[model samples]
Target: MFGRTKTSGKTSTTAAATTDHEVREGAKGRPTPKRREAEQRNRRPLGSPARAAAVRPGASKEEKKAAREAERKVFAEERALQRQALVTGDERYLPVRDKGVAKRFTRDYVDARRNAGELFIPVAMVILLSSLIPVAVVVRASLVALYALVLWVIVDSFLLRRKLNRITVDRFGDKATGCATYGMMRALQIRRTRLPKPQVKRGEFPV
Candidate 1:
């Protein structure tokens, strides 16, 4: 039966809802832990044997082997990242020789053009084979062709150096040291065979 005053008709709704186990509005369901108990729960073993075992001088051979393997794995992963960076032009992993905004611009400039030096290997090979043929006309023709190609390469290299100097000066406000040499070397290589492969396609010269 509802609790009600003898002289009142209204039911005691507050008395009906109240209970011995009722929780307060903002109370946590569980009791708060003591400071000491919290500290104990979070405590960790200091200088624990298991944690120090790997670095100890008297460590086991298995531990040493595991350490070495771990080192090699890290080294291999770094090398793989470096190799990929070379192809992708990732600055973080590129080697000392390949780093720099100026160098990147030089590479793009060289990659955009066709170089006569790229024919040196093939032409030289033909000249060597011609020498073995012992035919006067063949030998003479090959020599002349080789000479022409060499002259062209020299002239092309000179022009490339001059152009690189001008462009670097204009774009960078100062010519980058050794930029011409770096660009010329890269330009001399066959496009596909160049390391840190050409970033730009033919006719895609850097602005």
Candidate 2:
């Protein structure tokens, strides 16, 4: 009985080979019916037509001009109707101008007062000393002081008075006028603000 019996592992391998051969034969005999059905289902629908011709390229020059003229005519007709309606209507809307003259004047007066308070004494001293001193020396000294004073005034105006005026104008002036004026003043102030600084620091150690 032991001599006649085969190994269990050899028997299992033989069985597996037979099963694989049968599967290959089955697959070759009939292409899978389900796979064919799925391919047919995935195909694009034939009902819808292709897209219309690509808008016939760009219009010719004459066609473009004609279209523009047509649009202009329509616009002109609309504008004429609007004008007629406006002319017939009794209610007229006029834009009013701002009345900031009084405010501007008052602000200028105040600024003048402040500037004079700070600057008048030094100016008076310069003038008094210039009269008592030698003419050339006095002129040189006064000119230098006056130049410094002017620079100070310009800086003060831009930083302080101009900014204050812009705020006041926006609050009190007409919207359009105030905005335009403020824009111009702001531009000018910005231009004046970017002055060159002295290169030397006052208390630096020598390299």
Candidate 3:
């Protein structure tokens, strides 16, 4: 080092401005490190700093596995947050497909309207069970009724979708995007089981 010694020696030749623990090298091969200095240097890792170093690259299979595990942990946490939002109606964490005033209004409107598609499953089960009864007339009647119910569900769904589209346009204008199918699907779900946990009751709609 082109520097003077911290504490001046009697035989020093460098200027007074340079002062540090380092010995001034007038011309040298290399000075032998002191015992403590050598030990400390050996102990310290050869790097810039421990904390300041960038994240290590995935250099090994184990490291890659650890990175993947970290990524999976983050994904699981995000999914958990979204699930909580769905059940608890936490707006901040709700997916984009379920957000905005229009979507909320659509949900409320669908919940408020009584759609026949909601009853299709239960009615079908009843028809199937009734067919088990030992009566040809009863079986025929059940089959006929099931067909009628299916037709009614289709008609009701059509009406429900139309209603949802009109509501979206009326409340949000033509510029607003529509989610008639989403609203229709929600309508088929029982109110109690619907996600984002229905904020409004059957009669108390947002729009």
Candidate number with greatest lDDT:
1
Per-residue lDDT tens digits for candidate 3, residues 1-207, read 334453455235354434433456663546888998888666633322321122343356666566656666666887999999998777788998898878877887777767787788888999999999999999999999999998998898889888778778877885347667789888787677789888776687673
Q: How many times do residue backbones clash in model 1? A: 0
- Residue 160 Cα positional deviation in candidate 1, in Å, after optimal superposition: 1.3
lDDT of 2 at 85: 38
Give the runs in model 1 whose Cα sits over 4 Å from its true position: 1-65, 173-175
**Cα error of candidate 1 at position 207, Å:** 0.6
Question: After TM-score superposition, what is the CA distance of residue 42 in candidate 3 from its true location, in Å?
Answer: 40
The collision pairs in model 3 are none
* lDDT of all predictions: 0.80, 0.46, 0.75
Off by over 4 Å in 3: 1-66
Candidates ranked, most accurate by lDDT first: 1, 3, 2
Residue clash pairs of candidate 2: none
Candidate 1 residue 136 Cα shift, in angstroms, is: 1.1
RMSD of 2: 22.2
